[model samples]
Target: MSQKPAWLTTDGAPWGRGRARLVYDNPWIRVTEHDAVAPTGAAAVYGLVEFKNLALAILPVFDDGTIMLVGQARFPAQDYSWELPEGGGPLGVDPLESARRELREETGLEAAQWLPILEAQLSNSVTDERAIGYLATGLTEVEADPDETELLALARVPFREALDAAMAGHMKDMLTVAMLLRGYHMAREGSLPGALARAMLS
Candidate 1:
């Protein structure tokens, strides 16, 4: 008789997966379909999408409490999107480097200070897409090198007005919306510099 591995513990068991098959794959994502045995002893099948990169977002705030937003037409949905500077970094690469590159590429702004603001899973049920957001300050202008596929328009808006627009549904990109709200929270909670926060709220 064969013995189960000691490292495989069922102490707080939920579900067990059976055989898995690769359903689809691409450079960016892969889909796997597998059989699963639920904790209730019910059988189920799961289709999982795995992302090959980490999503990185940067919210660049100028000293005057204005944010740099990028407007472009997003595909599939075929709608115009106003979003924070965002891009993908290889999974194992340092995300900050990706953030710096993306911010520069999109807005031609570089920051001396970068604060980690948010870490989250974008779609837990469907895809293993992870995201990280940063608040960037001490900005200086540089030359922008936008992606070939992007036709970007830059907008500098007051923090409060941008947040209000997002809250009113004018901005629907989840990362942008979340970061704007978080910036507001930081201002109210005194997590940011008093003058800067006041400027943002004002």
Candidate 2:
């Protein structure tokens, strides 16, 4: 038996009334289990997952301050639209490559330049997804080969309007909001933290 960390042992029950799967026998949380519960009482089996690592989301912005975004039918929210070029999960391709692929697949736009704008680990108090935001300029368009189920549209909203949409609950994607707003000032001024700090003070 591999040793479990001290933090994992605290305030722990059978993770409380959830599904159990003995995914890993060596180390404690190398386990991958999916539990179910009712959000509104006696509903369906919900998921209590312990995945490998956090995922990433990118705010792929281009020249002229336009953001590359995609809108699709979200089955979970029952809402059909609005999201960025994402899909940097725990597996498969690395984050930067995933960013470029998602951009090409969704928008048919490719970048000759790449800038690492913002990086973050997700709110573990809620979920475990890590995201990195990017500034991709010097773009050239290619033929768009969208997925059969993917119905996508591209919009170049001013950064302020993007923030307003998040505020008004229109652009309600969390990673989108988190990256854009927190990293907004940096994007406009074209510097990482230094120019952003100057913008904030002014």
Candidate 3:
């Protein structure tokens, strides 16, 4: 099958990219500053941060209408955060593989069913960080193997309560909030099994 052209994937006229050079480099990211001609024909300078990996977020729902959560202290925010299982996948690797590993490593839960739900450019203006969200169901317990650098707290909460917490500002992680809202939407829109949706909302 033929793939769509790259230019067809973006909206509006594309900026004419000029000379670009690496400003900084790290294992996880690279910063590049470039000269560009904007769509408006004005000269501009763009500083783009390119990620070496794709971000993965997983929302694992059990048969009992509950979801798993992980709490940890984030360095950049310097605050505690409760979020769904999240990790980074090598840019060339399958994100679902990373999601599965993250879920298992953090919560010791594995799911038989995985559904790709959403994709977002986390900060398109300044970064090329892309994230993928997945919905995992039919969960089972396993032994957790957390990353050496991570310290996490785990919880199992009813779907409604989790969503409420996310909406009520108790959970501020962007990926977590987006996943909760998306689940709520899927439940209401009949995308999920009726019984499961009812139980989740209950």
C-alpha lDDT of all candidate models, in order: 0.92, 0.63, 0.91
Higher-lDDT candidate among 1 and 2? 1
Best by lDDT: 1
Q: Which ten residues in a row have the lowest lDDT in candidate 3?
A: 1-10
Clashing pairs in 1: none
| lDDT agreement of model 1 with the native | 0.92
Per-residue C-alpha lDDT of model 1 across residues 78-195, encoded as one tens digit per residue: 9999999899999889999999999999999999999998888897877889999999999999999999999999999999999999999999999899999989999999899998
Better of 1 and 3 by lDDT: 1
The digit string of per-residue lDDT tens for model 3 on 1-202 reads 2499999888987889899999999999999999999999999999999999999999898877899999999999999999999999998887888889989999999999999887888878899899999999989999999999999999999999999998899999888899899899899988988888888888
Clashes of each: 0, 4, 0
Quote the lDDT for 109 in model 1: 97
TM-scores vs. true structure, each candidate? 0.91, 0.64, 0.92
**Which pairs of residues collide in candidate 2?**
35-46, 36-45, 36-46, 37-46
lDDT of 2: 0.63
Off by over 4 Å in 2: 1-47, 51-54, 89-92, 188-202
Of 1 and 2, which scores higher on TM-score?
A: 1
Q: Rank all candidate structures by their TM-score, best first, as comma-separated numbers.
A: 3, 1, 2
